[model samples]
Target chain A: MDNSVLLKVNQLKKTFIKKSGTVFNRKKTEVYAVNNVNFEIKKGEILGIIGESGCGKTTTARMVMRLMEESSGEILFEGNNLCTIKNAETNRLRKNMQMIFQDPYDTLNPGMRIVDILMEPLNAHEKNLPSNEKLKRVIEAIESIELKPAEDYLYRYPHQLSGGQRQRIAIARAVILKPSFIAADEPTSMLDVSVRAGILNLLLDLRKKMGLTMLFITHDLSTASYMCDRIAVMYQGRIVEIGPTKKIIQSPSHPYTIALVSVVKDLNYFIENREKLILDGEVDSTRKDTGCTFVTRCPHQEKVCHSKAPEIEALGNGHAVACHCHSNWLEKTS
Target chain B: MSTVLSIENLSTFFKTDKGIVRAVEDVTFSLEEGEMLGLIGESGCGKTTVAQSILRLIEYPGKVVSGKVILNGKDLLKATDDELYSLRWKEISVIPQSAMNALNPVYTVGDQIIEAILLHEKVSKSEAVKRTKTLLELVGIDGERQKSFPHEFSGGMKQRVAIAMALACNPKLVISDESTTGLDVLTQAQVIALIKNLQKKMNLSVILISHDLPMVTAICEKIAIMYAGKLVEWATTEEILNNPKHPYSKALLNATPNLSDPDREVVSIPGSVPNLVNIPKCCRFHTRCPYAFDRCLNESPELREVTPGHYTACFLEGDKNG
Candidate 1:
């Protein structure tokens, strides 16, 4: 309902049915990849979704992008529920929303030139534009990504470019449509460490220059904290915590979020000297219908956490946490 | 203060049709007993090549042309093939990068570890199996799952198994080449913790080769920054992270995304790493370095000790410290 909200996801759910048993007797098991997720991205804001692999962060982003059909829920994009849109309408809506995938190597067509990659989005979305206008737009897009001497890169193939250059091309393709909202899923994870900062800075710069709203999904908390204004911590198909980046890092409310933050290797020596709270045990993705996904590894889990799921409780400053022992944790820490 | 491994002016080159690819050039560093040294560099910077050369894993046209790899007291290069084979896994072993794929998928996790132990030591099959279970438990994997295939376990679990296999022969030195590259943050932290714990418990010396600076800082006591096969800088992790002196080292630290300092500006080092075959005659980094001057173009800087503990190869330090 807020005017500032650019995109709102309401109770989104997705499930995959897998066939089991022999050919004679078929049985099915539902894999709930994402379930009952809710969040919102403000206009021109970078909302980060942080989670481990198979935690439904990618699934959530895909569902919002409408790349995959959701089982149930509303994906409201600028007052329009994207889920209600028809096939023809969805094509038009895609112009305003785009996604940049994790692997740059797989995302771009190997045989295609950098110009063609950027032009594909424009040709599909802006079919009405003239040939000369399209060429101009393509050049503009290349320059927008700060790939100077755009002419040199325009005709070059993906292989001719470096990892950082290819990613910049991918970004150029995503923004060539002039999308108001974009979902970038681990864009810099595949890049070398020396080139990662350039990509991150380019994204931040592009966000301001284009006035774009972004949903940045990454498993690295440090990267999320650096780029995002707000973050939602997801675990096993559910969002366990949602708050401002500073709050999530400094005063994480959810036990899982706290564990995630604590595990990040800090660059500062003083912080490195402090004791680390090691979260023993691995993340079990196959566990079925558990009360709380994090209860298995939670340090302060109570008996109630094993049987009853905790509701998201308001923790002030637009922050929320879902944990049964949050109050007890607060008291103990204070 | 005893040195566990000392590499002196080590240079490894790969002969290709195009030219001689200088993979590791004049790289020198020493690792103390029970110390964890982090070798941080980009993909083509020859960090892994240095690690491989230590274990004599470089095959075919690639050769370690010069320098001595002195482990404990013996020169590893001069040791006989039979002696080298015996010394490997017994005294020094490696946990390679992408250990998940490095593991034998056909063999069960338990069998592979047991095979490693049996090959190194004149132990019975049953005794080797027992040691495998203990090693698995040590790395925090379920000993019962040893019967399962590599595919049956997750990525993190597979890496743990690899670590177990590396430690099967009770080797004193473990060279881990990008051990935690593909793992998620939590798993990476867990693996690093496991390595640190094991290092302290066994008094093991580790050569952790990775491009991930943060991960390196977490586990390593000393850090080495390499660029185009050259040792650009070497110092304590604290010194390297907090007071990087070399231009390449400073640029690398600046490029890393620091979450704690969100307001700081991010500046990337321009241009890619030099082509190995046509590497610059002087400073390889002179092409991309912002501080490069005419003097840097004519002569290569030697790896000099700028301070008591820290060493950097940069002509600019001479003006400031002189």
Candidate 2:
């Protein structure tokens, strides 16, 4: 493990068991939502985890934040195993690591004032601080997010503000603790395009200003490329590819990564000319241990792809891809 | 080219305590046969209202104030209930946003399609079921799944069924309102491809309303950019993407994150969308637009053709045409 790594996740696995059959006789089946995932986030780096819905991107983030208990794995934060920490110690660890959720409307309490929402985390973590100090901190946090005239927004309810404003309030609340790490899961997916850029830029500015390391999760590849330093492409509970943002965008190694990059519509003329590899079929979340989760739709799938699971192969330059046809892609492109 | 649908100065307002909420105001555009037009805007920009108004779906406090919706050379607003009923599904249909809730859970997927076919056309149960199976196959769904309930189908499959239901009567025009907003990227691409393939096969005109500029650019040939209840810019997809005329349109382009071009700077508009009730008499986007001038403060700009094919509603471009 790298010494500069702020968060390290090793062989993370989460499974849900469901009982089937009549009330008289019950049977159980295990649903592996996330299976043996490994990745690391260095200090001050924005590591993006991207996948389709039900692909365990959100589950991975939740496990990393310790919001959900993992079935098996090790989550190391600053040389300490977070999964083994006591309740009190875990609560303290939360002060250094925070999470920003997907939907701003649901994440925020409609009846609470913006100040109250921002102060909840502060009050919980910084209980020793006086009332005046808490108020000052809330005001400062609101100002940092560029909410403007913090006094006016302090008394306003979440419904009174626009979607973008409410999302900013959410970010302000997350950063008030000055956490060393943040996990934002689909933060801007619900926002309008005009305001989404503002939120993305805000996150980037805050990362630079506070030196915060972040795990940004999203399905939109373009956004991940814009904000993240490196990206780990997840598909069906596995990291299919991981590399620097530039390398991943320029030369995507994995077939799934290629499909994702090809789908990003843009103004570039070359993209219009290039042939699109639209992946057919749907993501099956309920399937039992299948060789190559993407085999059902891979355009270049071989007989071996369906019979054997490929291991993560290092392609050099901090890039690693998990695929059986990676050699074919290298040979064809190079 | 013959025009399939023509909207002239269409305005819709909702009577609210705040005031008359002008959701869609003085919006005019024409859709030709076999053409796909993308309506792009924020949530409250009235893109959905424009689509619903064409189908006369505006109800209660929300009413269409003025303007004519001429579909197939007939005035939809002045048409009687019987006349409108004959036109719907056969002439134009709608695929709404929520596929999960749009379908009836209690009824099997086949029964719903049969009901739709029976509503517009006098068809027997057996014949309607046969047509329903064919429609399902056209949209890339197994005909065998027609017996299954909506809850049994996956999200992507449900969306395909919705598309199938919309095309049961072979409508010439289809209006899809953010149909793929909640789906995953891969599913979104599949749904889009399905729509495009159907459009080509049937030579249908489609009105795709969504806030996602990238998705819109991928499918639609022409695009109309809306802001604050008004259409600010209208042009072919290429023209709109390559050279946006309005500040709002340019800002939207800059705001979108493009993987193909990583070096482009992201320019986010300053403020949020303004309240639609009692909108400003001047330019609606003046509050957030960076190019607002003295004229933009006092007088509203009409949608004027700035180029041979591109149109924009901005004081900055007003002088260029003159």
Candidate with the greatest DockQ versus the true structure: 1
Tell me the tens digit of each residue's lDDT in model 1 across B1-322. Answer: 7999999999999999998999989898999999999998998889989988988888979999999999999999888899999999999998879988998889999988888888889999988888888999998887888899999887888889999999999999999989988887777777777788899999999999998887787668999999989999999989988899999999988887776786677688889988899566688889889999998998888888889889888999856787
Q: After superposition, how far is residue A65 of candidate 1 from its true place, in Å?
A: 1.2
Report the number of backbone clashes for model 2.
0
In candidate 1, how many Å is residue B322 off? 5.9
Model 1 / residue A30 / CA error / Å: 1.5
Chain B TM-score, model 2, reads: 0.98
lDDT of 1 by residue, A56-87 (tens): 99999999988899999999998989899898
Off by over 4 Å in 2: A265-279, A329-334, B122-125
How much lDDT does candidate 1 score?
A: 0.87
lDDT of 2 by residue, B52-111 (tens): 899999998999999999998899999999998899999999898989899999999999
Categorize the docking of model 1. Answer: medium
Poorly placed runs, candidate 1 (over 4 Å): A19-27, A265-279, B318-322
Error of 1 at A168 (Å): 0.9
i-RMSD of model 2 (Å, 1 decimal): 3.6
